[model samples]
Target: MGSVLAFFVLATVFFYNAGNWLVVSHLPQRADAIVVLMGGVPERIPEAVDLYKSGFAPRLIFPDDYEENPPEVLPDGSLLHNDAAKAMHLSSHFNIPDSVIVIVKGPALNTQVEAEIMAIYLADHPETDTIILVSSSYHMRRALIIFRNEFASKGLEITIISVPSRYTAFDPEKWWQTAGDRKTVFLEYIKIAYNLLWDRWF
Candidate 1:
């Protein structure tokens, strides 16, 4: 029994590390737009900017995440909400022109809503057929699932690119070493399962 349990534990750890690599999809050379799904630490913006500067896309789309009654004044005296603040940072710090950076207007508080809003925008534009999605490394799997499911019938193609985040303590290589990383990975698996089942049945 002891040997059997040890073998199972070793197999689980091996799969966890190997699965992280499998979650990342191959990045395309170019796309119509680079859509940065907001929520992660500031790491996503820099990654998106790099992709944009590399000529991967002509435009950067940021979905305005919903915030209930945001504070009127930020620490810097800017009234911009979290999403808008990040957009401004992209423009000011990264030197991206406001014209090319589009802040998608709508109540997109989560990945599902963000995908829906992006679909509507693409439907109206018609010119943007492909998009490169920027998100955190651990989040890429679920994000791809949700976005692809949402845009399945819309004729829009999405490519996912993951950026390493400093905020998360989850180590992909040593995920089983810490309780936090284990919990994080466990929750992600649960969420992925939930999304799959929910989309299929409901």
Candidate 2:
């Protein structure tokens, strides 16, 4: 019993670092455009907006994730809440011009799909050589890798700068203390493993 408890404690200590392992952070630089990965809007969109406002990039790119669930319209004819809508609202609220925002018209149901869509978009616009990539703090590493691989596969030599969203409440040191964090970290590891095997097998 004592040995089992000791092993459990040891494992917990080592596993505590998984949250940090899943994260990647990089300082933003002047780029051709900023691509904010869909999902985690509350955290990611703001970061990308700030980067755009800071003159780090001239345009903001977002995948059209509204294909499956098109934006709803109220009786007042106003659009309901969605990532693209939310981003537009935030951009206007912050005094950013709508012209600088580019919505890549493609289905981006997952990170891999999003990467593929971005690659296709960039291929047509060879003038864009650098981009700032933004995602949730815990998702940045995987996203960066996927984007890099996708670009490489397409023979695109774009420079990618990874910047994790700063507004997330996830604390890497105590991720296991909360139910939300636990689920997020667990699913992330599972996704990492699945992507690894998927890449290897196919």
Candidate 3:
């Protein structure tokens, strides 16, 4: 009985904290650029576009690995990668001009690689001192940590703004009720732990 009670108590604490950690909303009033990290659902792009339209940033950057893959043929015969397709959709849907959208093409397979690519871009664009990073709510914490660690030596400011994902089954109010949410939250915790250790030791 005591073991069961202890388990329940520990789980309660974990669930509460997990929901809180999933959504880290530290948005700055203004930034030099708005960076939308690719990987999650299509919700991220729209959110970034909204931020851009709201005048949060003058430039929007998307770092994706689509350049390394074959171009996806569209119905209109125009060839575009998944990343470019999304960017184009945002451009047309939001009436954003093509010149304002900057696509940093590279082999960025994960968050770490994306951060590296972004670091290189920041190096080139010395005027961009502050950047707003937009990603899924559940991914914001890990993304922020990785970006902070990656840019620690670069003197760049990163502010995270999380957008709720339509595809991910992360329900902050009742995260433990569904199996998908449980699994995602569990995996996120593991990744967070791994990243923390890796950043510390290596």
Best candidate according to lDDT: 2
Judge candidate 2 at residue 79 and give its lDDT.
78
Off by over 4 Å in 1: 1-15, 18-22, 72-76, 155-170
- Model 2, 83-147: lDDT tens digits are 76666666677787889999887667799999999999999999999999988998987888788
Cα lDDT tens digits for candidate 3, 1-202: 9999999999989768886677677745688888888876367777777788888889888886655256767688877666645666656677878788888877687888888889888878878877888878788888888888887757765544444433444687787788988888888889889989998898
Best by TM-score: 2
For each candidate in turn, the TM-score is 0.82, 0.88, 0.83
Mark the regions of model 3 whose C-alpha exceeds 4 Å error after superposition.
1-11, 67-71, 154-169
Which has the better TM-score: candidate 1, or candidate 3? 3
CA RMSD of each candidate after superposition: 3.3, 3.1, 3.0
Note the Cα lDDT for every prediction shown. Answer: 0.74, 0.85, 0.75
If the candidates were sorted by their lDDT against the true structure, best first, what order would they fall in? Answer: 2, 3, 1
TM-score of 1: 0.82
> Candidate 3 clashing pairs?
none
